[model samples]
Target: MAHPKEVAGFKLGKLLIEGKTKQVFDLPEETGHCILINKDRITAGDGVKAHDMEGKAAISNQTNAKVFEILKAAGIPTAFVKIASPVAFISKKCDMVPIEWVTRRLATGSFLKRNPGVPEGYRFTPPKQETFFKDDANHDPQWSEEQIVSAKFTFNGLVIGQDEVDYMRNVTILVFEILEKAWGLRDCALIDMKIEFGVDADGKILLADVIDSDSWRLWPSGDKRLMVDKQVYRNLSTVTAADLDTVKRNFAWVKDQLDHLRPKVHHKVVIIMGSAADVEHCQKIGKAAKKFGLDVDMRVTSAHKATEETLHIMKQYEDTHGALVFIAVAGRSNGLGPVLSGNTSYPVINCPPPSSNLVQDIWSSLSLPSGLGCATVIYPDSAAVMAAQIIGVQDYIVWARIRFNQLEMAASLRVADKKVRNLSIE
Candidate 1:
C-alpha cells in the first residue's frame, strides 16, 4: 500500500520514484535538493517474502544517516547529505544506474552456487567485485565490463566510461576495507556487502543507494561460527512467528550495535606557534594537518624571550598519552622551529613566517642548524595536513577520512560541471 502521503517536515509532492524501501518526492521549492522517505517494510528474494517489520523505518533511517555521515566525514564518495528526520533525509537527487555492485571477502551464497567446487569457507585474498544489471524478470543478470559499457546509460548528460567504472571498482574495495576494519575494531565481521552508484547533475558518479541491514552480511566476533545477517533469516525453512521474532531480534541487534559505533582517533596535537602576527601563515599548515585528522593548536611563543615558559607548556603536553605534531612559528633568523624540533623527540614541523624584508625566515626553518630534524611547511593547513598524514599511517580512522575527502572533492567537481552544462542548455 502507498504511504499516507504525509511525513515529518516533508510535504510529499508528486511521487518521483519508489524503491524497495524508500519513496522519493519532488521538492520543487527546495533548491538543488530532494527528499527520500524510509518505509516500515522489508523484502527479500526479490520481494518474494515481503513483511512489515514495525519500527524498521526509523531504525534504518537513523542507521543509514549515521553511516553516511561518517562516510562523508571520512571523505568518501556518497550521495548522502544530511538526515532530515527518522523517516527522511534531504539529498541531491541523481539518476541512479540499475546495477548492484557486490564486493566479497569470503566465498558465500551466489559464489557457492556459481563455483560449486570452491569450498564454502574459502577466502578471496584480495576480495572480489561483481555487477548485476537490475532487471526483475531476469533476476538482475550478472554483467561484465563489456556489458556495462554497451548498456550506454547516460546520467546528468555524461556518458559512463571505463575510467568511471575503474574508479568505482577501486573505491568499492576501499569502502569495504574501511568499513571492514572499522567493524573489526568493534568485534564485528563485515562478511560482504553491495553498493550502488548514481550520476549527479555533473555526470559525476557517487556511492549512492540506501545501505542498511539489507546491504551486508555481518557476523559478530569474527566467528562466522554464529552468523547474524539477512541471509540467516532468509534461509529459514519455514516462516513461523518464532522465526520472525528471531529475525527481528537479529535486526534489532545490528541496529543497536550500529547506534554505539564510533570511529577511533589515534593521535591529537596542538601546533603552538610563537606569535599572533604569523597566524595566517600558520593556518595554512593547520589546514594540511586537519586533512590527516590531526588536532592542531596554533599559538605563538618565543624560545629566547619565553624559554622557561615554553618548556613548561611543552612538558604538560608531553605528560599526556598521545603523539604531538608541533610547528614552531617564527621569522627573520628564526629559531623557534629548530628549537622545538630539537627539544622534543616528537614530530615537529617548522613553519616560519615569510618576511619580505628579511627573506631569511625560510632558512631559519629549513637550515635547521644541527641534528634537529623538524620538517618545514609554508602553509598552516598544509603543515597540519602533513602532521595528520604522518600520524594517520597507524590510524585507520584518519586514513579513512582522508580517502573520503578525496572522493568528495572529485564528486563535487563532477557535479559542478553537470550543473554548468544544464544551465547553458537552458
Candidate 2:
C-alpha cells in the first residue's frame, strides 16, 4: 500500500506514527492539525493476529466520525476535526498517551479470563474501569491508579499525575456510559470498550484516538449471538477467504446501525408565563436550557384570566409528538404551574420570579393542590437544569451535556481549593 503525500488538498508532511490499523501524518499547511488515515487492516492479541479486509478502512472511518460527532455535541472535548475522505479524517495533533483505558458493563472476554469465577454475563453496577500500559511486547499489562500516578510521565509539557489520572478515568467512564445509553436507545448493548487520550500543543487533555466497531464489543438486543464487532474477526482461528467476507459484512452492518443512533424525537422545554411582563425571567431560563441542547418555546397566557388559552397552549405542545417539559414562570398568585400540571401528563416546574411578596409567591408554588406533581425552583437556571434532567431521561445527548457540566463544576472547585491553599504559603 502506498501512502499519499496529499489529502483533501492538504499536503501530508511526514508520517508521525503508524499503528496496527492506522497512520498519522502531519499536515504541512495546518500547524495544529493532522490527518489520520485508516488502513484496511485489523489486528488482535497485541498484533499476534492480523488480516486485511477490503474496504474496512472506509467502514471504520464512518463509525469513528459518527461517534466523535456525538461526543463533541455533548460537550466532551475530542481530537476529531472532520472527515477528510472515505478512509481518512482530520484531527488535532496531539502527543498520544500510552495508556488504554477500558470500561466494562458486562463480565466477558478478558475480564472472564482474568477472573476465572466470574460468569460470562455478570453485570457491573457502575461499569468497571481499568487502565493498561500500552506495551505490545509485554501484552499491555493492567496498571493500578497508583501505578499510573507513580510513573509521572509527561506529555506536551503536562505531567501525568494524580489529577490527570482522575480526569482521564472519569472521562473514560463518562464516554462509555454516554455511548452505552445511545446504543441502548437502538436496542443494542455495549458490553465493554477501550479508549485513549492525548494532550494537544496547548497542553489540554482531550478524548483522542478512534472509536469504531474495532473499539467495542456490541451485541444487538443484548444477545451475544447477534454480536457485530471486531470480536467476530478476532475469534476466527483459521481465517479463510469466506470468513473475511463475513467479517466485512458485520462491520458494514455496525456502521449502518450507527446511522440511526441519533434521537428522532426533538425534546423541548416550554416556558409558559401568566403575563408578558415575565419575559425577562423566561429568557433567562431559555438561555440556560439552550446550553444543554433543549429547545425552548415561551408563551404568555394566564390560568386565572385566560384559562382556556393556557390549556390550549398546553394541548398544542402535547400534540406535537415530542417529549416536552413545561416551566411556569408566574410571579403573584402562581397558578400557571398547577393548571399545566393538572391538564397534561408532561412534567411541570414552577419558577416564581422575585416580587414584593416573595414569601407568599414561593409558598403558593410549594403548596400545590392534590394530584398536581409540579416542582418549584427559586433560580431560573435551576429550573432549566430540572427541565433538562426530566427530558434527559430518554435523550442521551442532553444527558451527556448535563453530566459533563457536573464534571466541570467539580474541576473548578478543585482548582479553587488549590489556589486558596497556595495563597497561605505566599
- TM-score list, all predictions: 0.84, 0.96
* Candidate 2 residue lDDT tens string, 9-49: 87999999989999999997898999999999988898899
Query: Distance from true position, residue 213, model 1, in Å?
Result: 0.8
> Lowest summed-lDDT stretch of 10 residues in model 2?
417-426
Off-target runs (Cα >4 Å) in candidate 2 are none
lDDT of 1 by residue, 296-364 (tens): 665667888888788777777777736566767777766676777777878877666677854555766
| lDDT at 98, model 1 | 83
For candidate 1, report its TM-score. 0.84
